[model samples]
Target: MKSICGDLLLQRLGPEGLGAFGKPLNRGLYECIRGAILDGSLPRATRLPPQRDLAAELGLSRNTVMYAYEQLLAEGYLRARTGSGTFVADTAPESYLNATAAAITDAGPRAMPGLSPRGQQLLANASASPTQWGAFMPGVPDLRRFPHRRYAQISARLWRQPPPEWLSYGHGGGLPALREAVAAHLRVARSVRCDAEQVLITEGIHQAIDLVVRLLGSTGDQAWVEEPSYWGIRGVLQVSDIGMVPMPVDDEGLTLPEADAGRLSGRTEPAPRFIFVTPSHQYPLGAVMSLKRRRALLEFARQHGSWIVEDDYDSEFRFSGQPIPSLQGMEADAPVIYIGTFSKTLYPGLRMGYLVLPRELAGAFQTAHAELYRAGHLMTQATVAEFMQAGDYAAHIRRMRPLYARRRAVLAALIERYLGPGALNAQGSNAGLHLVLRLPDDADDVAITAAARAKGIMVRPLSRYYLGTPAQRGLLLGYACVPEEDIGPAFDVLLGCLGECGHAAHVARIG
Candidate 1:
């Protein structure tokens, strides 16, 4: 056993072995042994060499070996037997050991656990980017300029002396203070008609949409989504087993047919149980739903007994004209679930968002939210509440609005300069973090997007946002996170890719 121990240790610990040359020898030995144990090179319950023998073999002082063994023993990595030598402890938990065994045994091709139909659909329809932050990555804010210092201070202060209840599982509706703050801000800023009681906090629009889908409708129920809509919401609907009817969008937003035609004639699909829209600023395309359209939608929903989900994400960043009031607040008792997120206005990592539910539905959604997800994060909510109360939230938006506007202008100018007129058309630049660059009818947006990505420019294919065959071919170029200086260069790279795709000719044309 002793002879075999030396060979095993020497083989495992390679040439410049146990001790890091410049560091303390004992600490280095300790780290090497710890790593070996963690990596399963030293199996659980394997006997370790006696301290004196190990010291002799390694030419180390007995005390040093003893120290390392003692530390390992104290940490439960090794167990000292009364009459026997030290062995690796069985402290590797059952779960860990089982997982390790499974990994080893299942190394070859094996039947993997099958996903549900819905799970398979989710995997097939997955649109989340592998890398979220970089040049021209759409839908991300400029995190570099975020007020981290102030937020950190507030976070630290709250954590130091948090309320007793706050440390526990929070209210399903969210932190009271946060709900009030959000309600007050929404009423004033976005004209959302809601009080604190109606504000149900969620992880973000993702979860908010999930709750609405689960609570209001059942599996196989029909819902209406824009022709080219936000893919995230489409995913939620699909996973919920809800059938989605893709409604086309014009310059005025979702173009719904007359209710009588939609319902009576078999030409159009039957009225959906719910309608999902981004009316404040249409996603990817940047068209505001006209007041007439908004009223028409509300009337349609009212007549059809359908609920509306207005995802007013990034509405606060509007660059031109007065900000639009929410569709939810436009009429009295409008059956609209107004969803907003701090992810865009603040930061995505915060994972805070809220829904202004209809008065009667709030209680049920709150109960289900608690039952299903078990709400917490009161500390984060409280910190955000303070930030809003102190007027920092509003000030941050004020500071970023112009900065984003400049970045938008730079990207737009580059497109006009490089791509030339009639080469590519850019739309939806009046508001939001991104805009749509419409390609020619013959262009393959998916191939163009892949080409752009290969050049280190991250742009989404406009066709990917559609439920069925895309009506238009284009790219969704996000300029929010890209610095003003980098926007031109990134778009130039993209233009080069476009030229390669034969979409843009190298003719000199005036902007």
Candidate 2:
């Protein structure tokens, strides 16, 4: 019996070598003997040779063999009677574990469980583009031109002597220094009325709005959003089980919802509890909110006790005229939650943004944000603060402003020359990084978008932005990320696609 066990041990530790298991000699020896015992090569009540004898036979040091024996004994794989040598344990996990593995192997493949209702709804109305980078992918910026060298230097410097708080999860919105830097910048640049205490750091606008919705929004409540606004927040609201009322937008931003006396225009719906607006440069349309409309919206929110959520997403690179002031700062004690993100100004991967809450809500939001999101990215916040302090952030934006303006000009001119003068959206006030190319209302924009995608150009159908009946057919052409020279070639491909789709500018003009 001892010979049988020894033979099996040698077989396991033999041709493959003792180091075959990628473990130390002792651990390897222990594993080999334990496996032999579990497989019943050494039966219960079978006495074995002394440790020294096994060591001699195996060509291992006495202590290595001793260590292997000790481990087996400790793990109940082997036992020693006071007067007898070590033997295999009376029972082992082999009977149960081996039976389980065999049963599972015989059971064959399995189908995954079904998703929850919430999970199903999330997949239903997807907004993100599969092809994120290319000639005309909308909302993506030029990552190639980011100031990586300066950011790296700034990051390295801060990491060398970082304050302890910068290395850990933060409380009180974010690092104080970062909040102060953001506050100072927003006040001068966007004319937002906020102090350092009111600014709360976030991962991005997504997380910022998630916090807002979770904190303020109730399930089954209604919110008003621009008909063709960014799909992100609407998705957030939907997942929260909040209903969306798509308000129409024109040349002066979101048109006030029509009056049916006290109810929503043309419907019996109640007034919205929340209003989401992109005032500076309306997302797809690029219509700046006129002073009259902005004032009217504020008064409505004030009168109805509704919260106004202002998403100042990409106003930093405004290329024409003086900058539009933020809707939040225009009124004292305004019921506004101001959201801004660095996704547009800096690279999207940075995932840094801030919110300027109404003064009363600041402290509660800081606590709630820390509790809900477990706020992190202290190192990123610190680095951005250092960059701002050194004026690199401002300088970077200044450099990028003109670069984007030049790209926009080039793309706009190309559209004019190739697609004709009426190709552009007249309401798209020459400011943002993209241009909305108008199309015939009768044309099938979804079909055109698919055709353009097949031709290797990435433009979103303007109709896809609308939650209600699409008012127009068009394409969103993003030039910021596209190289200046490549814009022409890409537009040529797109123009050909327009012809193939039979929705060219001439058709729209004739109709």
Candidate 3:
């Protein structure tokens, strides 16, 4: 060999490589030389042939070889010594190639590096369903009925005449216009005591919960979460590494624990720092927190210096009279943080909700929220503001209430018809999108849930919602997404999935 194989580049470049298809030879030559160096066809430090000699060998002009070499040199793909020829630079691309190959070989039998321990733990306890929308899918709205025309019209209009901050990442406490609108709506509809300044907009209820818990919660702080509560909220707490004490839920909502945590556990937990409750309508089980209990919760929080996170979920669709007023508005300067989501009222994908914080702490939380999530979506927020201010939001809620009411009635009847009257758990049936269908204690709710999912219905196992060993067994069946006409057919499908042990007894009595 003449010091180094100058023909290696030519061998890798191939017969049709540089001049193929009438492509520009200079650029092609550059790429071919670079590729050879990158792929190890031309080993590092291997000197290339003289430009004139290489051009003559390849039947190209001297300028072409010079151009490719000059480009490669300028781009660090080649190095030149004072009197020596062009050579491939000592790049570590080969190490990467070797590592990739080694990884493939090692991956076959090895446990690869996985997520963080906390991340792995959070995922291991996850309960979110793969399929979100189907028969009896809880918390999903009727997607067909979303007011797309108005939202699009407003969105297009905003984009057409865009303002300076139309899409800006400003708004520490969310867009002022949207905050004002939310404040007005909550004051009127929910009786939430807040000015626009107190409203902290968020992506949704989960974000609101997470924000509160992370900011208000501290090391060794414990939160009183309702037993048989929303799993999503619990997941957030677990990820934050905050301890939770599952308080029971009865018809009155999250029941106050009779004994101190230390007394029960034989170890003193720091006096609880937060209390989470769905006071408007209890989740999975529809019980409104009584005014007495609400007052007591307020007093307890006052005593313990705890912040009560009141999730006013699905309070708008009450079949009877007006929805319950917020726990935040219960007493002046009450230690309650009222949170609500547009997911239930509008649509889940809308991904907007708000927190009505205490006026004393609102600004600090707003700054923290801005720093944390880097809140934006001014356009969407503004559109919703316009919609609510113009009474369109209330109008949508007005229309949805009766529609959901009819579907709920239809589903309830079918449950009573097919699964028997006793199977329809009356506790959570009166309001909200979903109701519980009780099963016997020994019944396999998880198996029933799986079977129903296989058959294209989606009811949740009640036992999964519990923070402790489940007190009872049942299934949560949502009627909001299911149309009136679809309820009977869906329940009939679900009924077929139920085993004879718990279901047939009820069915037999009916028969």
Candidate No. with top lDDT: 2
Note the Cα lDDT for every prediction shown: 0.84, 0.85, 0.83
lDDT of 1 at 283: 86
Query: Which wins on TM-score, candidate 1 or candidate 3?
Result: 1
What are the per-residue Cα lDDT tens digits for candidate 2 across 169-190? 7899999999999999999998
Q: Give the local distance difference test score of model 2.
A: 0.85
In model 3, the runs with Cα more than 4 Å from the true position are 1-112, 259-268, 500-502, 506-511
Q: Which scores better on lDDT, 1 or 3?
A: 1
- By summed lDDT, which 10 consecutive residues of candidate 1 come out lowest? 97-106
* Model 3: per-residue Cα lDDT over 1-511, one tens digit each: 3323446656756777676626688998887777667667677888788888888777789999899999999888789998987788997444545653122123467678989998998888899989999889998889889888987888788778878776678657898999999999889988888999999999998899889988888766798899889999989988888888988999888887544633323435655788999988898788889999998889878877889999888888889866688889879999999999899988988899999998888888998998899889888888899888888899999999889989988888877866678777656736788988888777888988998898899999999999899987889998899888888888878877885334645542422
Tens-digit lDDT track of model 1 for 169-233: 87669998889999999999999999999999999999999999999899889998998899999
Superposed Cα deviation of residue 6, candidate 3 (Å): 24
**TM-score of every candidate relative to the true structure:** 0.80, 0.79, 0.78
On TM-score, the candidate that comes out on top is 1
Task: Output the TM-score of candidate 3.
Answer: 0.78
Give candidate 1's total backbone clashes: 0
